[model samples]
Target: MPRTLAERTAAFPEPFSRVRGLRELSNGVVLLTDWIEEKVFAVDFGKGSATPIGRVGSGPREFRLPGRLVPLPGDSTLLNDVGNARLSVIGPDLAIHRSIPAQRPGAAYSMSPRGVDAAGRFYFEIPPWSQGPAAPKGDSVDIVRWNPRGNAIEGVGRVKGSDRPSWQREGKPRLTPGIPMVMFGSADGWAVLPEGRVLIVRSGDYRIDCLAGGASIGAGPPYAYPQLPVTDADKADAVATFLQDSPMSGRGPNGGLGHSPAASKEEVAAMVKTNEFATHHPYFRAGGVCRPRKASSGWSGRFSAARHRCSMCSTERAGWCAKCRCRWGGGWLGSGGALSTR
Candidate 1:
């Protein structure tokens, strides 16, 4: 059975030694990490003090904002770049080696990538954000599997087609905890299980979705149909329908409910249908200083201006809604508005 939060904490190697950071290498050595203030530390089974690796990021070259790190074959380390959009390889000393850049930003969610393969090939993943803020409307994402050896990333499958592995019993830790199959964002990205099944998690009605890819597979829903008329009421209905199964409402880390409008309307419909939404609870993953307990307190104000604390504190971000942030399809709203020092 998967250990509960308390159980996992109790089983820590040492008391008072909380798990602050975590990353799994391609070699299967999961880094039990801790970041005290600004410094970083990770441990091995030897109980040696965690090495102070330089920094982490999700950019192409630098660790700009490393979401996760995987130990590549031959002592090489690949850092998933959240900022620069690339896979950065670093040496034992934490020096930059080579980087595999993403074809587009927003495509790969550097936060979670499966890792490199046997023959020096890297099977990375991109979320729905691959399409820049402005692209042809209705354009969704396609999982691009990058092969550094060949300097190419072929489309392995669409966001919804890569899930056979996630569903099989092969990927879960056979002996230990019971973490359900969640390939990145429910079924929104790439996941290759230990069984070698490459399954896609999709968003809408399966029949309407057109699965597309190379030898691999991808899926897309039909854009215009009798059921989806281009009327204001229909649009509202569609958006309301969109909210029902959006990843933003899930209970994953930081509230699990993070929204990505990159998927086109048809894509959105498909994602909901696949039922591959994030499952982590967001309330428990929140990070924020104690809110000044003045001029606010109530469930009603949670969405109102009075309640300023993070609603999804456990998993919620420290910003305003993505729509309110900029013309650029990201949410800048958070504890710190124009100048709150939040």
Candidate 2:
């Protein structure tokens, strides 16, 4: 018989309304981003203290809707200020050092920083579609690499995006209504290793594809997991969770990227419950890829809706390495090389 590993939970003095990002700093502190609170915190788990970094504003030392925290060289970290449409760098002293525009000069679009490489190149995803009159023109999204030193951007690879169901009014040709619920949506997951290698996890076939220097290196063997059927209980739980965390209702003072006015709880619940659900869950969920460090294997953890658990798999040298099980939630690689989930 094999022994199962026990799970450990880290407790903070105060609870976080919504935590979107986590990164281990060079000085053994964990940096956290609270999207709903619109703040950044430096949490020292060993000392059991979380210190707020800055205030909520659009000024040099302030930020709005602080999103992902990307670790950069030295003891600095790159923060995505989604509301302010820029990136801020925090030094080892936990102070804002500088800010950079999220969008390049004359570029039609701005992107969030997805990953950073050893050579200081940044990676971003250009979605295949946008809301309103422009719909998905294709099935794949492009991954671009940006070298800030030369202000150069180049297409490195392409990955498939999710295909969720939507609706449109009978007489409104220009209006594309949003889907209230997508029960078994599938989308591609990707991450960039510090060594400049990109790994894409395909949800359709549950396979891993590898790219290096803008060229295809190889692909890993597909993991054969059963697509369990959805149940009534699952549908009820999904709706309840969505209602509790809906952006329309939960957006703070920043107003949430220009969404419609907040919908009443009852109205939102009714709208979500009316949407049709899939019979079975997709192979894997999107946005679940974990960033890998240099000389380490890449990990992709997919939350299985049917099983109510997470299925974690690793890729090494573009080949399948191992598989494991864990609780369903976002996680990060700790300094001691352990996986910590919340």
Candidate 3:
């Protein structure tokens, strides 16, 4: 049985402007990335200090808009440098060991890394919603497996694309009105286990499906959860939170990446007035699934749609285990069951 533990805070010397990624290394050093600041830092929580890992630039040793931090074998970590369009390996000594291109040779789209295996092969997903001529057209997206040694990219599995409310108007597609710009709708989630198996969380039926080498191995029983209705308060809250946390720059009106200013107060108020919401929350949160390094269990943190703070649940080879709620970000789980947040 999973029980709640006493909470404690590891305060840093300076407050981060915006923390996008956080991961605890084997040596107890926490590596964090500040997206808005476009920098990465190595923080010693016991010493109450932080040191910048790499400079902020497009150079080899530097990175711009450092995003997800994926833990690799041999005490090393993989940093997704979104702005530089590459992945960098942070060595055990806290130095840049090498970098890998985000896009493979002769590939049309860049790779969005999700997890890494023990043998150092990367599992990534190409953006299904990629715009313009190269955008993939389909209701499903491919989960690609890439081997760094041989530079081979293969399709390992397929999953559903994002579910957004849109319709055709004037012979063109347009977003549906009354829909909150951001809502916790049903969508699929996936993560790579330490043993190189992929776990896909199907939201439609609330089930866990396992895959290895592009083949379905097994599946757990479906989780029976209530469909909680969305209320007026939920719509208002979602809009407020979205505006508050959104970046001041580098976002387009349709919620894609571009150079546009943040939405104005009037625009937000209009959205709230016309915003529609789903009747129920998704069975599992999207982009919230991750497995701890060297652990048999996989964990999903937080239930934003249900308004449950710090709630976590685990899925193993057998089935799902609902754990006690605890305060922490939805990052990697420690071996001893400690939740490391971002």
Candidate 4:
């Protein structure tokens, strides 16, 4: 079982609305992004308090929905302001050094996380729809690399596997959320290694690939999927779990038993039949966990190298960091409890 290091009631300068991403540095400083507040907070574990890195706005140093914080050398880091369609470089003092637009102004292309290679070339992923009329000609697409010192962006490595949606493959129109439609074996996440190789993490299947230039140099350990299909017992158990987790279960809008006080077995069975696979197997893992206040008040998380190969750090859980090598435990900041590393 995982153990706790330190636990306390953390009162930040302000309450966090929604924590999108977090990273712990080698110096014992924690950085977190609040999706709702649209700013990053740097907390000192020794101080037991938090400070906002930058104001929340659409200006140069401001952020919209800051999701991921990638730390660079010399205490500088990159903030992925996904909602703003830009990346901001944060200095050691938590000041915005500069901002890099993810796409051409008014362009519709969606960019992936900004990763830095050993040579310091920043990479961006262009999903198919965002590629527009001049999108790549094949199913496999490449990641773009931008040199910060100069003004040039070039295609470097390819996104290992294809991520075409399941609805498209089944010849059906998509009406539900786009995430569940993403095929299981498709590429989902990628990170640039310390040696400049790109590490790609897939979802459709559990696999990690290390790529150089545009080819695979090697791969990490393989993760086998659950070969068994969804059984009736599994369906019932899933429904039970959902109901037990639902806050509105057994209560109506007026807080009283309404037309249907409880879910019927038949209704649950129908729901299972409709959403068994999607509900059980979420699109992808967020790669971190958050512990409850009773156990650990402050943020405690792990770090991952490529698809959660947690060998570099000492923690029993898995997370990702560019500068830290500490083995921390916890989940994604807003997960409410510890997240599973595997």
lDDT of each: 0.35, 0.65, 0.66, 0.53
Top lDDT hit? 3
Query: Model 1 scores what on Cα lDDT?
Result: 0.35
Instruction: Please report how far candidate 3 places residue 217 from its true position, in Å.
Output: 1.3
TM-score of each: 0.38, 0.78, 0.77, 0.59
For candidate 2, lDDT tens digit of each residue in 209-242?
8898788899888776666676665566556545
Worst 10 residues of 4 by lDDT: 289-298
lDDT of 4 by residue, 140-242 (tens): 5667776767757677676544435455546587664233322223334565554556656554455666677778877766555433233466456546544
Which pairs of residues collide in candidate 3?
A: 178-274, 178-275, 178-276, 179-276
For TM-score, the strongest prediction is 2
Candidate 2 lowest-lDDT run of ten: 313-322
